[model samples]
Target: MYEWSETDLMIREAVRGFIDKEIRPNLDALESGEMPPYPIIRTLFAEFGIDTMAADGVEKMLATQRARESGTDSGGAGSGSGSGGGLEGQDSLMAVVISELSGACMGLVSALGVSIGLGATTIMSRGTLAQKERWLPGIVTMEKVAAWAITEPDSGSDAFGGMRTYVRRDGDDYILNGRKTFITNGPHADVLIVYAKLDEGAAAGADGADAVPARRDRKVLTFVLEKGMDGLTQSAPFKKMGLHSSPTGELFFDDVRLGRDRLLGETEEHRGGDGRESAKSSFTAERIGVATMALGIIEECHRLCVDYSRERTLWGQEIGRFQLIQLKLAKMEVARMNVRNMVFNSIERARAGKPLSLAEASAMKLYSSEAATDVAMDAVQLFGGNGYMAEYRVEQLARDAKSLMIYAGSNEIQVTHIAKGLLGR
Candidate 1:
């Protein structure tokens, strides 16, 4: 976990080579939001057999689900030696891919993670047999784009309490109404997992609603949706300061209708700790993944800054000779090392089959994001006037890095999570 294994380094080179050939040539278009990252991503997946790997993972999960249902899963008693390690390696490889991609375009990494990591994962972890079979293949293969919609126009930090989106029961069908903003891949997603509470009035009248179990008080539900569904309106991508390759947009559902089959886990009860817990768990993985993304940005910025320092002249000598320039390079190096270690530590913990605490995930996200944003800005400064120009790339990196602080869970929210964990309340 201290350094990339030889195999890991080889994979990095392969990914880097693909990026150079496919992504680098289109950098301008991507930065300008003129091109979506999917075509490039699909090429990457095809070359690396990522889709094959995803297909296999989905098959195994479904098999596991089937076994559990049949009462024949044997409870891991027959799992082969190194199966655990294989899972760990898979996690490590995903981090490597994210790191490499983020270094090139944080937007591409964000889009991929949202579609595969968050969207596909939500369905896999919380879905039933029929649901997994119906949805996971296209998602895993990149044949379909997916968006996990939880944040609404009204809910920013307070997702659950502020969520105004509601689903009203109508016989066996449900009518959904609400708007979601800041949704990744939203503008063009083929599949979506949207979160909403059963309408408050519906909740008050449903069976067991009056008793109001504390756990079910929120009564949030997750529904699988598809494009072209009646009353589902998705806006074009938003013009944001960063993540142009990752299309962010708004969704409006004016009485979009769905049946019970669309319900994740096919249950209205705590199919998985009320829907909020499901979203929170998803955020932990997303938050931790951000640290890896941050490490990539820090690594790239440090490399750029160091190269610029050694080559650029000032006062008749290389800027690297100056104490101030040295200080910036040194700090960037420190951030790179620290974030790298954070990523490796998370990998090692996962290898041991340990789950990161919510607070730990938040801490990792908070520190690494700030560090990345700081390093990118510092890189811009060290490059002088050249850095202000997008041609220099530092400007783009700086802009992209800042968005990390706001996405996933905002740094402010991260602090609140950390403090709540510390206070024992």
Candidate 2:
């Protein structure tokens, strides 16, 4: 229902064309365990500005201007200074780009999402000016791939409570010790945005008590750790049910010493003074990024399912001819529309400088991810046996769709968040 600009339309068409020519034909190879040729993927993203679209440009001209005005950049490793309109416009444009790219390949979309949404945005939101200066260029230029390290072996839905990682401050340096699991792009990441607890004392209490203790508040902080940081190690890519093209792995940080500058936002000692306000601003933008990715996947699943239903036949008629099929397709269409609108509206709200309640962001992720999974499963059903086969794209979509609900935040957690919000908690 959202109106698209002339440039938006043009970009969409161009991205579609590129995917058709370069990515669609290679889906089989990619799904069968071979990574898509990086050159082609890289070229498409570069030409379309998929990776650095948030920044607008490399000279930092627009970003600097926005920073001067809004006190932050366009959702990158800094603040923006521009009017709300500029930020909203960028979000809309980026959403279009994400949907188009994801329509062809979710794995590629995930890569781009991690790099721009999680990687670059972390720095923009929490990185010091020096850290931003050191890291933003390579990210925007696609020279360095980035990954987010938040989930761990025991922490998925309960990320904050389940974190076992600890950081010990020692003079001008901090020693990081922990392990991260199921990290996207972990094996390929040149830079990692890791979250660890600063207060080891808070974790010394009883088991379940420490899990979600109040004192652990100071433990919730982020750090920008890099590859080859001493005691940091990455395991080989783990085979996955879907998104095989994306390299997923575990990360181990054992007493990795980092300079003071590596800490994100403020340290625990200074956190109570200013860190809360800063984290609020940063997380608002980061949630928007995650919501955008979810919207993209949902839109792609809906569009593809609809298209497939219209083409495939059963009992001498197109499957889409059946009333039940029509109903499924209609439901998907409605869900897609709702999610798209929610995403855009959230971005607009964010641009207007409103922080999203945990419920709002979780709602977007929950609804869109569920929609994507439902549509993907229906797409496979509509395709019959062909959908189950790897030869067709539907099977791949179904596989890729599985993770959306689990990542970002589980649907169950999203439900809990919504409940908490309703209870006014």
The candidate that achieves the highest lDDT relative to the unseen native structure: 1
lDDT for position 197 in model 2 = 71
Tens-place lDDT per residue, model 1, 1-425, is: 47888888899999889888998889999988888888888988899988777777666766766787789888673222112211225877878889988988999998888888788877777777798889888998888999999987767998887787889889989999899999999998999999998864634445674534432455899999999999999999999998878999999999998999999988888545878888988888899999999999999888888888888997899999999988998899899999999999998888787978889999999999999999999999999999999888899899999999999978999999999989975
Error of 2 at 26 (Å): 2.6
For model 1, where is the 10-residue window of minimal lDDT? 79-88
Q: List the residue pairs that clash in candidate 1.
A: none
Residue 173 of model 1 has an lDDT of 92
- Candidate 2 positional error at 238, Å: 1.7
What tens-digit string does per-residue lDDT give for candidate 2 at 185-213?
88878889887877555445547754566
Off by over 4 Å in 2: 36-41, 49-89, 199-218, 265-314
- Please state the error at residue 259 of candidate 2 in Å: 1.7
TM for candidate 2 is 0.84
